[model samples]
Target: MDIEKYIRNIADFPKQGIQFKDITPLLANKDASAQCLENLLQLVGGQKIDKVVGIESRGFFFGTLLAQKLNAGFIPIRKPGKLPYTTLKESYQLEYGMDALEIHEDAIKKGDRVLLHDDVLATGGTASAACSLIEKLGGEIVQCNFLIELKGLNGIQKLKKHIVNSLLQY
Candidate 1:
């Protein structure tokens, strides 16, 4: 669907030298959003997914839809204190400093197969931390999916143990 065309690039966004791949344009276009979701689903190849673990805010967009399509529960992995429940946290190194992500302690059951989704795979810290949270809760990661991946950042290196797929890479 040439989804990249729908992604608007903002230079030096949120910080200097950072080029943000904005998805707002894509979300605004119904057909592009649908096609992107469909492509993300294809990455699963009809695998049995019990839960869709979405990383914080952006992931929730397509993550919820993917969960619906897969008939799986949507689990949100958010910043510290965002979840109103007993939670499990995992900390990771970011460019600036260390950060943590939290998920409800009971979100996943033992042996549950999970599909992790995020908007972008930058340095892999965020997604990797989310994976740790899922594993700690006894969930098996089925696949780590993304809408966009910055290949130059080498985020995939941290996620080498699992199947990683992305709709677009820059």
Candidate 2:
């Protein structure tokens, strides 16, 4: 699908020396978007995921579709105070600054196998923090999935203790 071409690169976006990988172009292409979703679903297929935990914002887009494909419940890990129920929160560092994420307290039951999904994995801080929250709530992290991964960032290294997969790498 030449997904790379569809990913727009914004130099020094949100900060200096940071090239942001934008997926808006890919989303505009119907065929590429469908293929990307299918590929993501297949990559994590047969993992026995009970819930798909999608991080805030972009993760929600792919996470919901992946959850539907796997026939598993979609769990959203949103920003703090965004959820309407009792929740658990985790604060972490990003390329810009410190940020927080939240997940419903009753989202995953004990022993539930969960797959965390996001559009891109930059530094592994958000994903790792989400994994910690999921475990604290009794959910087992089966895998973590992403559409694009920036190589040499060592984001995957931080998450090396778990199964992590990405459809594209840059």
Candidate 3:
């Protein structure tokens, strides 16, 4: 599948001077979404992922699917106060602004292998912060994967220490 075609570009979404890569089109198409999920699985290439962590909103879409496909625990890295239980917070910067993500203190067991998923890697702040929370809880990150990565933003620079995979780059 030409997954890139499913990505719709929106000008000045949420704010000006930012081009948003919308995945709603892809999500609406069962075939493309499945193909993208298969591609994500292929990126793992048989790594044993004990847990799959998805970022707050958009990540939840494919994150749940990935967890089901892998038979791994699905964890949500949500915005502050979103999680009901005791949580650890990590603050970070975004391309447009600043935000924080929270993860349950017990989300991952010590030494658990984690796969982090997000819809897009724009500034790396969200992913980097989420990674900190995971490690603070003693979870070893296996990989950080995304549905789309904005290459010009160089989000990978902040995630240089870990394996980062993406199905589509813009």
Taking all chains together, each candidate's TM-score versus the true structure is 0.97, 0.96, 0.98
lDDT per residue for candidate 1 within 61-157, as digits (tens), equals 9999999999999999999989999999899986446899999999999999999999999899999999999999999999999999999999999
| Superposed model 2: Cα runs more than 4 Å off | none
Model 1, position 96: C-alpha lDDT score: 43
Residue 20 deviation, candidate 1, in Å? Answer: 0.7
> Cα lDDT for residue 12, model 2?
96
Tens digits of per-residue lDDT, candidate 3, 1-170, equal 89899999999997999999999999999999999999999988899999999998999999999999999999999999888999999999999899999999999999999999999999899999999999999999999999999999999999999999998887
Off by over 4 Å in 3: none
Error of 1 at 14 (Å): 1.0
- Against the reference, the lDDT scores of all candidates come to 0.94, 0.89, 0.94
lDDT of 2 by residue, 1-170 (tens): 66677889999998998999999988899998998998898888677888999998999988999888888999999888899999998898886789998999999999999999999898888998899899999998999999988886779977888899998898
Best by TM-score: 3
- When sorted by lDDT, best at the front, the candidate numbers are 1, 3, 2
Report residue 44 deviation for candidate 3 (angstroms): 0.6
Better of 1 and 3 by TM-score: 3
The per-prediction CA RMSD against the true structure, in angstroms, equals 0.8, 1.0, 0.7
